[model samples]
Target: MSMGVGIGRREITGMVVGAVVLALLPMVVQDSYYRHLLIMVFIYGIVASSWDLSLGYAGIFNFGHMALFGIGLYTYGLATTLLGISPWIALLAGGVLAALAAALISLPILRLKGIYVVLVTFAFGQLVVQLIISQSDYTGGNQGLVRIPSFHIPGHNLMRDHKLGFYYIALILLCCSTVFLRLMVRSRLGLAIRALRDNEEYATSRGISISRQRLITMAGSAVFTGLAGAFYGAYFRNASTDVFGASLTTLLLSMVLLGGISTIYGSLLAALLLTIFSEMIAGLGAWRPIVIGVLIILVMLAYPGGLYGAIAAAARALRRLGRRQASP
Candidate 1:
């Protein structure tokens, strides 16, 4: 029940400081292009972090995670355009629908392990793509859905702000998702999943219900992922089958792995870093992907723990140096 697993004074302080800096970032960086990229970071941050809950913490090999996002995107698009619902409600509907899909998928994989889980999840993702395409009457198939409604403030214009409103909204979404994921990972639920991941037989021996925990893990991870997808649809005012493509799955998987596993903050950091870094190397043309791939391999080889591990290692070294200086 305790949701304060690894959080401490330093972590709390870091959260506060990081929030302040990001909140003030728009003022310092006035470029709309960069603002757009930051918004993407926020979106991917939510996604990669939520993924950490299942893939990293719970040890679930859910290759269909992006499907949840796609479901949200299409859900929001259809809800607003077809069902005549408010964009805001449709946004939440995306999450709910994706979570339901996750639960449904979990039922079959309850007893499966390893690559079997991966195969089922990956197939599920492809199945979703096929379904969307087959339902072209509503989904727009390969053409995608266009003219999706955007969010509205009471008296303000969201469109005229040069993406300022969207940026803040994305940031808020990332913040909420991070808080929710952190709480989930720090709660008893988190402990149970970690146990399951480490040793399923041992965990079940300890009276933990594998089916229940896995079910919750899958559903919990899908919530924010679907929300991000919904926001993606709303922000761009479009929904496409491309959302379920392998390219995006690879990108998000990179963020999760490069950020470090089992640490919620790691995925968020990786999302921020990778997005900015990819943009920075955009001028590399075809070499961009090659360069990025090489960089990921090198970093993983050097520090298997990823950026979080590197940061933690550096922090420990600095503390050791400080202690040495203070010692007689």
Candidate 2:
């Protein structure tokens, strides 16, 4: 929209440089602690960016992201365990299952407005989690599944490989997901989804097919979130039902919110900043959440548009300064 927000050459260059630094981080920081943090940032960034697709662009404001994610992990866990399928194949299964579930629920659920939509989706999320816990036979219940298989890239078992390889896998996923999302939002479906968010009534009057578009975007959102969950499970070789709690959901949501909803770059920036901060504070042992929460609240208050929003604005300001200085 405005130059204040659109990514430009300088901004792109900065992002590329930042990504390069991250890719090389594992070489510099050999400690698993910091390497794990970087991996978390990359995985969580993908999740937050996916959440922004619906919450930010589609104005769906879904609080049920964790449900989609849970379904994904369970789907992968079950597939690999039961069918003897590879983790990579199971990962695809997870995404498809999540998409199907979202498509099934979107129409009736998305009909409501305001808090009702939030409430319904939230309830759905809670229900899914409980269902998983209850069906211990299929899902491993609340105790969760263990020894999950690692996702393989051809012959490469990412689980057993170099930390740098894992980082590259995650970074590739993030970059590809980001580009895919941008294209999806800019395509015909993207236009419909944005319209549905901005003005449902007018969009409907114009033959936008709100229900159809919502179903598609919801499925799309679930795919990304599900893939992230699959990656998370593979990285850790475990998936606990309880771990997919409201706090984790809130964490992803917070990243999207603090990053600037509807902006993937915002999601990336927020995830990196927030995750790194949280990990650092967590070294404080018992008082981590307090510190993390305070930092989040302070950032929220200080920059309402989230991390990337501020970065984008500052970049634009710098461009203007440069142009003025160059002019006679």
Candidate 3:
């Protein structure tokens, strides 16, 4: 009990320190280029972490997670640009639409298991991309939606020129997302989701509604991911077909895998590391993807449980070694 309490305290301390560092990051790093990279990190971090809620925790093979994100992106962009809605309201609308999309998709696909779920969800992602391309006029098709809009208040709308403002926004969003996910994973609902993941039949026998739990998890995950997507569109001032691309879905999956499945914060850490690594290799031209692919493969093979699991294992080994040395 004492050891468990100590571990809890350490975790809390680490989280507090991390929050402080992230909050002050913009103040210390004024470089626009690095700031932009960090923004991407936060955005992808949220998306990846939320994706884990369903994929890792609920055991839902949701390959179309990115599709919900893309839906949010397009919805927010269209609402703000076409209908001339406020940015704040548009952001909320994006989350709502994303949740709705998740619910709608979950209705049919939730019944599926194993590879069937994966295939249907994967197809859903592709379907979204093709639909956007087919409806060129509204979606901008292959050209994509350019000059959508940037985050702005009524009077102080300097986010276009100043990256600092956007950095803070991203930071706050990431923090909120982290807290929300953490709370969710600790809640009773989270337990039910995990139980379903570990033993679906057993969980169902215990009176847990698998469909209800999974649908709720899907909606929750989609909300955060959709918000990230909306932020991506607004910050970059564009909504491209690439937002719905499989490449992004692949990248997000790699982050979750490399970070450790069911480890929410691990996904965030992995997102930050991977995003920075990608930016560093951006000058590698065509060789970037090849290098990233190799790195991911190596990490997956070497650390089957991911970086987080690997680190934890190393720590435990060290402790055991210390205990042996201290023995009389």
Number of the top lDDT candidate: 1
Candidate 3 TM-score to native: 0.92
- Model 2's number of clashes is 0
* 1 against 3, candidate with superior lDDT: 1
TM-scores of all predicted structures: 0.91, 0.84, 0.92
* Candidate with best TM-score: 3
Better of 1 and 2 by TM-score: 1
- Model 1, 96-177: lDDT tens digits are 9999999999999998999999999999999999999999999898999999998888988998888899999998888788
Q: Any runs in candidate 2 off by more than 4 Å, and if so which?
A: 1-31, 152-160, 284-286, 301-303, 308-328
Model 1 lDDT at residue 193: 94
How would you encode candidate 2's per-residue C-alpha lDDT over 1-328 as one tens digit per residue?
A: 2222244577568768876886777778887667778889988888888889888999986888888888887888878876778888888788888888888769767568888889888888888888888988877887788888876667675546556667776777777777677667767788777887888889899988877778888898888778777777777777887546745665777799888888777888889888887776666875765666666788788878777667778999999999999996
Regions of model 1 farther than 4 Å from truth = 1-6, 283-287, 297-304, 309-328
Task: Give the lDDT of residue 58 in candidate 1.
Answer: 96
- Model 1 TM-score is 0.91
Is 1 or 2 the stronger prediction by lDDT? Answer: 1
Off by over 4 Å in 3: 1-16
Which RMSD values do the candidates have, in order?
A: 2.6, 4.6, 3.4
- After TM-score superposition, the amount by which residue 127's alpha carbon in candidate 3 deviates from its true location, in angstroms, is 1.0
